[model samples]
Target: MLRNIPPLLSPDLLYSLRAMGHGDEIVIADANFPGSSIGPTCIRADGSTASEVLQAVLTVMPLDSFVPDPALTMQVVGDAEAIPEAVTDFQRIIDQVADNPARVQSLERFAFYERAADAFTIVQTGERRLYGNIILKKGVIV
Candidate 1:
């Protein structure tokens, strides 16, 4: 294992994150996502949950502060006002990494897919909870 690096980040993942340019997006999706078909490049952390993957990714990936919404979560179906418990938990983790910069933006399911299409890669995690999906935009180190 590498020192100071989160163990959840595999060698391939690290390479992809480093290779991605500013504004490039990365999807940390739940097990239910059809990543194999949707994601251009897919990383499988089959046994670990989405929260676990999110934590690892945040350790290395910098969130784009240039945009109003660097973090995007899936909106509740039918009821846009409803915030599921799973999303709440993920929000807490994201807030910690974001340094409380701005609130996460919720996107319609179809829009979320369109946005994720621009991601450099997608990490399909083992989180089976509904709405356990999030997309993050990469930012410059400076």
Candidate 2:
């Protein structure tokens, strides 16, 4: 076991995160997300909530400083302004972990899905909450 690494992050997930370059994105998906068919490498964090996964990932990966919105969440259908509980947890985690505070933007459902499909990897969590998925772009270590 490695010191300081979140146990929820399995070897494969850690490897994927390490492999990603600046600007590459990773998705922390809910139980309902269609991760397997999303066309990117997928990692299973079964039994972990999306908030847990997001926190673990952010512990090691820095949020992109070059983008206006390095963090993106899926908007609730028909309620673009609605913020789900899981997303609120995400924002709190970002505030605590990110080097610079980053704003979490809401994307239309399909647009979020399309972005996930293009991510470097998707870590599917067991969170049962609606709209628990979040995408994070990697930032430079400097």
Q: Please estimate how well model 1 matches the true structure, expressed as its whole-model Cα lDDT.
A: 0.84
Worst window of 10 by summed lDDT in candidate 1: 95-104
CA lDDT of 105 in candidate 2? 95
Backbone clash tally for model 1? Answer: 0
Best by lDDT: 2
Cα TM-score per model:
0.94, 0.98
lDDT of 1 by residue, 63-134 (tens): 887898888889988988788776787778887865434567899999898877767899999898998888
Candidate 2 lDDT, 6-123, residue by residue in tens = 9998999999999999999999999999999989988988889999888888889999999899999999999999999989989999999777669899899999999999999999
Q: Candidate 2: lDDT over CA atoms? A: 0.93
Identify the runs in model 1 with alpha carbons over 4 angstroms from their true place.
none
